[model samples]
Target: MNTPKVAEHIVNWLKEYATNAKVNGFVVGISGGIDSAVTSTLCAKTGLPTLCVELPIHQAKNQVSRANEHIKQLKNRFDNVSEAEVNLTSTFENFKTVVPSFESTAKLDLALANTRARLRMTTLYYFAGLHGLLVAGTGNKVEDFGVGFFTKYGDGGVDLSPIADLVKSEVYELATYLEVPTSIQKAQPTDGLFGDSRTDEDQIGASYDELEWAMQMKDAGKTVEDFSGRDLEVYKIYTRLNRINQHKMVPIPICKIPNNLK
Candidate 1:
């Protein structure tokens, strides 16, 4: 989809946004995933001082290595790019110890996993404030809006979302055009918050490709039977996810009084 032109547009947009906001630079939390890689690279391309922080809370070794490699590549390619590594494993463990045990291990596990994202968000803002930079979010359209997979006020909190409009497939296309590391481009997408090595699709109950298609069909006002082909269950799963997580994609709802009452 004219990847180069799209990339150029995003880069210019970032630059203009930063200048208009009067921010010094951008701070991106690098997760070693294609989204973060592309987002960080786009920020770096703006020629503003970009700090790519690798905050690993018991992250997989391969993931951490990929993050380092990406930072190295960015530094070599752009003079404005820099890197930082903050290992938060011990901090997460300490925080977990303080929490009261829950009867439901499942609920506890989910809460702990979400805590990791919040921790990373806090770390990003710390650096952002220290350097007078804005936190550049790495979520794409499919994850951020399609299924609402991101944690609210965690990965979803940022000063700007440069790639929030691009779908997962489009993100991959841009990654390829940006010449992102082959290993990163080939790696499966994960939230890195589980502490385990489970891929995002494994937890999401549907592949990103399927979800993207469902999102498009829904946006076009198509029914499940219209595009389900063979597996009607896939459409059901996608719709359920979208319905439940819809809150994450929009602003907080507030009760409003009528003008006549006022």
Candidate 2:
């Protein structure tokens, strides 16, 4: 693909979309990942007011540093780009104290992680409402569709998605074309949700490369057995995740009555 041309097209598209929407500008949450970096850069390219919010809820030191560096770079490159940092650590702690917890030990960790994402979502929307900006989502195609790796109504909640069509690998390509900070471009991908350091692959059971390939196969009407790779386990893991997380990938189902009944 022509990376630069595609990047320029997306940038222009964002500019026009925001203009037509009659909104003030774009508000994006910077996670210091390739997806966020590229998405924020695209917003910056619009030359409109762009607010990059760094909401750290006990975020890792390195992650916070990367986010700061990204904001610095964006501010230097785009005159209209601005930033805000909201530390949600105390808020999250208070939330955990008051909210009732599930008795099942099996699901508590995941629940807490999702809560973190939802908190960030709430922060983004708060800023969006205050500034009359739309929340630009950072999720890519592989995670957003293939495995549904994002937290629903959390990272998944957004007014617009600029990179949802590109897979993880494509996001890296776009990041390179956009000259996203080399450190962020090379850093391992994480959601910055959990207390401990765990890469997305750690939680997803397969690397993004493997997941992208499996997604392609599945889209082509193939199954895990159809994959030619020697590692059967990888294919199994991909297919399992794809099946289980399909709910997150699709629109919520609602009960409907037949027209004949009417």
Highest TM-score: give the candidate number.
Answer: 1
Each prediction's Cα RMSD? 1.6, 1.7
Residue pairs with colliding backbones in model 2 are: none
Candidate 1 per-residue lDDT, tens place, 181-200, comes to: 99999999999888788999
Residue-level lDDT for 114 in candidate 2: 93
In model 2, what lDDT does residue 100 have?
A: 86
Clashes of 2: 0
How do the residues 1-262 of candidate 2 rate in per-residue lDDT, one tens digit apiece?
A: 8998889889888989999999988999998888999999999998889999999988999898899999999999999999999999999999988988667573888888899999999999999999999999999988888888999999999999999999998999999889899999889999989877999988877899988887777778876566565456677877787789888888899989999998
Q: What TM-score against the true fold does each predicted structure earn?
A: 0.95, 0.95
TM-score of 2: 0.95
**Which ranges in model 1 have alpha carbons more than 4 Å from their true place?**
227-230, 257-262
Q: Where is model 2 more than 4 Å wrong at Cα?
A: 101-104, 228-230, 258-262
